[model samples]
Target chain A: MGKNKKITDYDMEQLIGQVLRYGVLTSGIIAIIGGVWYLIQSGAGFPNYTSFSGEPARYTSLTGIIKGLTEGSAKEIIQLGVVILIATPILRIVFSLFSFILEKDRLYIVITLIVLLIILFSMFGGLKV
Target chain B: MNILLFTLILLLGAYLAGLAGSLTGLGGGVVIIPLLTLGFHVDIRYAIGAALVASIATSSGSASAYVKEGITNVRLGMFLEIATTAGAVIGAILAIYTPVNLVAILFGVMLIFSAAMTLRKKHEDALQEGSKLSYVLKLNGSYPTKEGEISYKLKNIGGGFSIMTIAGVLSGLLGIGSGALKVLAMDTAMRVPFRVSTTTSNFMVGVTAAASAVVYLQRGYIDPGIAFPVIIGVLAGAFTGSKLLMRINVKSLKVIFSIAITLIALNMIYNGINHKF
Candidate 1:
């Protein structure tokens, strides 16, 4: 019974657009943070670029820089991979779901759900061959 | 090589690639492969894995919007996917066993071909309807052009299907979106109107990517450290690009992109041939 705001302000497309932008930005931020974290945690020596893979190079090389970043305890790296594996897809599916809702179309929703289920089961079902 | 840092560099690389690829209309995967393998010295296999994830993100984020706008022919996309996915699965298997050198050489050749093709005449400006298969499949559809809705039918269903199969294989083998090949199949071989073919191709790319992505993930080739950044960055960039598409001349940009891809592919070939361990 009071003053009414314009309906245009609450448009669904605007909301969807916000979600799209936010989701993408957040994911990018996470990726950058993860990369930096890996570098500091690895504590590998500063690298040199000259030497290719061999027994060992005496001096720091360019590969050494990248190697320093890559050579970490397997457990820690694997753990990070697992976390990202779960996080990335879930975000994607969530965004995609929102899109389906925005469109108000039921066309591929079932198929998407089933495809997602397969991916989830395959990833986490713990069925090792 | 710490895992986290590897992920970080890959994220940066992908972000750079996405922004650049969008500006150039080359597609993210094309730029990412060279950046990872040549610029950062990442293993080619891992680079391809990351590229595959990025390709899906790029297509999914951008193409979904097009679908919402009702420009994409979803039915056409679904129908063609059966052939593409089958081709993708076979191609993925081949990628795992094919010698790295062969992959490199093939990639190089493709890059050259794509560059030349891009420089060729713009087919959208010259539309010719020829084949009967397009009519049988109802590949003909109308799209919103500036002048209004323009309806066009397909001409060559068989030829188009064959091209889709090849596109799927290339996508699986190289972790690319394979949009160039897809467009060529529809625009040149099938004579489907340009807009319809491109959007439909975009619609199907996600399916193609998923088919091969599953295989790659199972093979342990998909490192999350690499995939996460790529997926995120590319999705964001592609989303932005889709919005800009209505305002830009994507065709002109595509020519430049093709050239860049050629150079990147050449670099990959050189590296693969030289990296004899």
Candidate 2:
């Protein structure tokens, strides 16, 4: 706490405000592009919209999303955008964790860390049950 | 139906969902899920997944504004997210495992519960003695006001945490943002101000939606065809709806939309009972 450099607490708030605003707007644009591509490709006729065909592996999981991003896959890119949208809030939480730590706020640091862990566990744990 | 027509129809429906949802302060996530599942005859799994993702959009659109205005208590949101995210993960897992009929019925029941809660106009958040947890965590904070800055404190930490968990579980299980339930917990049990609670709840909904979204994604519940349009449409809808809220009588619109929500809930419940998607 004593060793930390001091800055306005408002800095963290402002940074987060920008993060949430831009994350969404950027993701929204990407999603629209991906969607337009999808409709054009599938526009020939209607497929069975009622059937539940699980998306291919390349577009469903986090690693798959990253992999698809490196390659140029439209649906996968859409998924990647969705992934980004989800990641934004998680990033917000991470930002808050560091802010708490920098301020040397013990209780909030612990609480924020616990929150971070739960989110990471949920994202990475892949619990089947 | 042709792809163009299908896309156009779903887009319009989602747009309306967003407009009405945002206008009601309920978030479009709720309406879009039921709309996709019941109105459009899509699978419930896909509906939930799309709704969950669209909720992130809603959060981003609304929360950034709240944050910039300083109405959102980001610290408070982060602290409570532990319960919410954990609950969301558990609920998402539950949704993955539960039968579709059961999920639909539960969603319908939740809708009824939410509408009943909102049917009354209860805005009295009385002053209360602060809790020990609030002191330990420094959960008190201030917001801007006309006269000056008005500071507020958190109470019933234990109760707030419990309610948050329920809100999270519902969000994940149903694939909606669950802002109504979250606001109720913060404004009532926690004694946060109305404005602060709404903004903070909006801020937290994204994280909760994301926590469940990954699980849904891994399970292949989300479809690009469905999710893409839902997200874009809801985004456009909320974006415009925020602008629209200023020009009209928001309360009267809420009254009309609230009835629509009730009917949609009943329709979902009926479909669930009959095992008809």
User: Candidate 2: which stretches are off by over 4 Å?
Assistant: A1-7, A66-71, B122-128
Prediction-by-prediction clash tally: 18, 0
- Model 2 docking grade: medium
- What's the TM-score of each model vs. the native? 0.70, 0.93
lDDT of 2: 0.79
Model 1, span B168-221: residue lDDT tens: 888888877677787787778767665576667765666676667666655545
Candidate 2 positional error at B167, Å: 1.0
lDDT of 2 by residue, B46-129 (tens): 888888887888777767766777778777888788888989988987876788899888888887777665555644443445
| Colliding residue pairs in candidate 2 | none
Query: Chain A: TM-score in each candidate?
Result: 0.39, 0.83
**Runs in model 1 lying further than 4 Å from the true structure:** A1-42, A45-129, B1-9, B23-25, B125-136, B243-255, B275-277
**Candidate 1 chain B, poorest ten consecutive residues by summed lDDT:** B122-131
The DockQ-derived docking category for candidate 1 is incorrect
Retained native contacts per candidate, as fractions? 0.07, 0.74
